[model samples]
Target: MKLATYLDGSRDGQLVVVSRDLSQAHFANGIATRLQQVLDDWAFMAPQLEELSISLNHGRCRHAFAFNPAQCMAPLPRAYGWTVPEDGGRRASDALLGPHAPLRLLADPVPCAARYAVLHGDVPRGIDALSARDAIRLLLLAAESPTHTAFAPVAVSPDELGAAWQNGRVMLPVLAMHNGRREGGTDKPEPGADFGRLLSDLAHPRALRAGSLVGATTAVLVPAMAAGDAVRFEVKDEAGHSIFGAIEQDVVLEGTATE
Candidate 1:
C-alpha cells in the first residue's frame, strides 16, 4: 500500500493513505497520526493501515479526498538516523525536505538520481544479505543534493514494484530531468547497487535504529546544477505509471526567496 505524510503545521505531519492511481487519499488519523508511529510498531500497525488502503483504493471510503503532493512532507520529515553509501558509507541525523521543497545551494552541486528505504525495525549486527530484506518497510525515490536531499511524494511497499524489485535492488531505470529536459544519455536510466549488500554492509558496523533512512545513488549522472536549475527524478513501470511519484525541485541560492 502507498503512504504519505501531509503537512499539518507539525514536525511529524499527519499520516494519510493514498490510492493506487495517486488520485485520491484518506486521513489515517484514527489508525495512526504520524509515519514514524506506524514504523515503530509496524507489525501491529501496518495490517490496519493496509485495510484502510484497500478501502480507499476500492472507492469504498466515503471521506476520501484528492491526493495533493503540494501539501506533503517527506514521508518521515525528521528521521531518527540517515545514512547513504558514500566513502564506505556515511551516517547522519538529519531532516529531509519534501519533494516540492526548494533546494538551497551555497555552491552549485550535482544532482544525483537516488533511491532510499525506511527501516521497519532495528537491524541486528552481522545480519546476512537475504535476512536484511525483512528490515525494509518501504522504498522511495530521492534527489541527492550537496546541501540537502528531498524525497518523492510517497513510500511504496515492495509488492507494488512487482518484478522490478529483484534480490533487494530495483531494476527499473531512474529518469533524471534537468530544467524540463531529460539529462541522461538514454531515455532509460541505469540501476544502482544491490541494496541487500548495501544494507548488510551498513549493519555490519553497528545496529541500525528503527526509522533510519538508507539510500544509494543510481548509475544515472547529471551535470552540476546552478541557481535556478530544476531537476526531477522518477521511476516508471513498463506501462508508464509512476511507482513512487516524483521528486521535482529547483536549485536556488541560499539567500534567495523561496516558498
Candidate 2:
C-alpha cells in the first residue's frame, strides 16, 4: 500500500503515522517484517536488546531497533536506508522526520508465489497491469477512501520486495501468519532457500536450471525508471577491469511499454 512512517522526535511514544492516507492503506510491521524476513540463521533485533553480539557480513550493517513497529512515522532521509539510532547503537528508530518521503506501494504484498504467477502470468496476459508505482498508486487511491480499489502494501526496499518474491512469501491481506502452511499449495513459486543463491539465479537464470534465463526464472525486477526503485550497477570488461556499459531492461506490464 502507499505506506510511509512518520516518527515524532524530541518526544517518546510520539511515533504515529502522520498521513491518514498511509494508515488507511496499511501500516504494516515495516522494519520489523523486513528484518524478520531476512534474519535467516542470522541475528534478531529488538528494543532494549543488549549484551548480545550480532555477526554481520562485510559491508552489511546490522538492523537492531531499526525494526521497531513503534517507529513507523519517522522521517526518511534523502539518501535511502539511513535511520536515526537511539541508545548508543543499541537501538534505532526512523530518521528524516517529516512528511514528503515519497511513500508508495512498490509491489503486491501477496504471497511471493502468487504475485510471481500474476507478474509472469496474469500481468503479461493483461489480467492485472500494474507497475510498482501503479501498485502504490492503487493503494493510495484505495486508502484515500476504500472505494477506489483493493489495498496492497509497498516495500521500503526493492531488495526486500524481491526477497519476498524470491522466497515466495506473502503477507496476509489484513494480517500476517506463518505456521508452515503451504501457501498457494501447488501454485507457489519454487523457493530458492537463501538470498545469495536466489539473486544469483535471478541474475543468470540460464546458468541455473533449464539452461536459460527464461525457464522457471521467477526473478522480479523493479527497474530504475520506476518510482521507488533503485539499483547498484557494476561494470567489468573481459579482463574484469571496471568499464562503462549500457544495460537495457524492462518490466512488461500489460499497459506499459516493453523495454
Candidate 3:
C-alpha cells in the first residue's frame, strides 16, 4: 500500500492518503476527537491494543510507543503536551507552546482515490477491519514521520493570512533554509558601517516587525522576493532593542498564512 500523509505542524489534526489492493482512502484524526474520549475509554487500553502488534512480526523499537499520542490506553483527553522544537536550535522566546496543549484536526475523513484501506490504531500493524474513524484515530496514535521537523510558524505580512483563507488554508507551502548569518562577535570596522557586526543586529523575538520570519531553529522561510523589492526586518532582542535594517532575503511565513 502507498501512504501519503499531510501534517500541518501548527495544527493538531493530520491527513493520510492510502492506496492498497485496488482501493483508496483518506482519513483525519485530531486531539479533539481521539484524545478527549481516551480519558475514559478502557476498550482502548494496552492489553487489547497490544494485539495489534502481533501483525508486525518483528518487535517494535524504543521510540515505538512515543510515535503515536492517540494510542496510549491512558485516559480521555490524554493531554499530550507541548513537544519542544526538534531542530536542535535556539528556543529564545517565552511564547512557546506548553507541553499539554491540544492538537486539533481541521477536517473529516473520506475514502481515498487510491487503492488502499485506511486503517487506524495506535499500534503499527496491518489489519483487515477498521472503521473510517477508528483507522484515523489509530493512525494518529501510531504513525510518525522521522523527517517531520517541528517549527513555529510566523507570519511575514498580514496579506499572507488573507491569501491563505482564499486558498482554503491548503497552499501555504514554503521552502526553508539556514540564513547563514552568525549572531554576535567582535573586531573592528568603520564606525557605524561594519557589515558583519550589523548582521547580529537582528533580534530574536516573538512578534517581530513586518518582513521576514525566523524560527527557533534558525530555519528561514522566504515569502515573496522580486528583484528590486526592498527586504526589511526589525530585530527586537531580549533587551527590547529594535534594530531596523534591510534584510538579506525576502520575508517568509509559516503554515497557513492566515493563522
Candidate 4:
C-alpha cells in the first residue's frame, strides 16, 4: 500500500491513502487523521489503511480524488528523529522538506539521491538484523540538500515493491536530473549496508522510537544547485513505473527575491 501526507497548514498533515498507479487517493479520515497516529499503533491502523488502499486502487472507492504531489508533505511531516549514515557509520539528525517544496539555500549545494525507511514501531535493543527488518514499515526516495532533505511524494510498502526489494535494500537505479536534464545516476546494485543491519547496529545502544526515519544516500552526484535551478530524483521498477513518485524541487537563494 502507498501512503502520503497532504499539506494542511499544520505540523502534522492529513494522512491519505494513494492508489497503486499514483493517480487517485482517499482521505484516511475515519481510520486515522495523521501519519504519526497510524505509526504509533501500526499493527492496528495499518491493516485498515491497507484495505482502503485496495479499494482505491481497484476503483471501488466512492470518494477518491486525484493524488497531487504538489499538495503533499513529507510522509511524516515531523519525525520523532531522523538518522542517516555518514562518515564511517556516524549518525546525524536533520530536518525534512516536503516533495515539490522549494529548497532555499544561501550557497550552492550539491544535490544527492537518498533512500529512507520509516519505522513501524519502537525497536528493542540488541535485536538481530532479521528482526530489525521486520520493524521497517515502508520505504521512500529522497533528495538530500545541505540544509534539509526532501522526500518523494509517497511511502511504499515492501510488499508493493515485488522483486525489487531485496533483503532490506531496493535493487533499483537512483536517477538524478538537474534543470530538466539528466545529470548523473547510480546503477542498480546491492547496498553494502542493508537497512536491517543499520537498524540493528543503532538499536544496540538504545531503543529507537517509532516514526524515526533512517536514510542512506545513493552515489548519484550532480553539480551544486544555484538559485533558480531545479533538481529531481526518482527510482523506477523494471517496467519503468515510478515506485515512490518523485522528489522535484526548485532551488532559491535565502534572502533573495525568490524567497
Clashing pairs in 4: none
- Per-residue error for 93 in candidate 2, Å, reads 24
Q: What is the lDDT of every predicted structure here?
A: 0.81, 0.21, 0.22, 0.81
Q: What is the TM-score of each predicted model, taking all chains together?
A: 0.93, 0.19, 0.19, 0.93
User: Which ranges of candidate 1 are over 4 A from the true structure?
Assistant: 86-88, 109-113, 185-191
- How large an RMSD does model 4 have? 1.9
**Which 10 consecutive positions of candidate 1 have the poorest summed lDDT?**
86-95
lDDT of 3 by residue, 88-128 (tens): 32322222221112212122111100000011123222222
Tens-place lDDT per residue, model 4, 18-129, is 9988999999988999988988999999999999999998999999999999999989878877776542343344457788888888687655555555555778999998
**lDDT of residue 52 for candidate 4:** 98
Which ranges of candidate 3 are over 4 A from the true structure? 1-36, 42-44, 57-251, 254-259
lDDT tens digits, residue span 62-123, model 2 = 34222232233222212121111111111122232221122223342212211111111101
Q: What lDDT is reached at residue 26 by model 1?
A: 95
RMSD of each: 1.8, 20.6, 21.8, 1.9
The deviation in Å at residue 13 for candidate 2 is 13
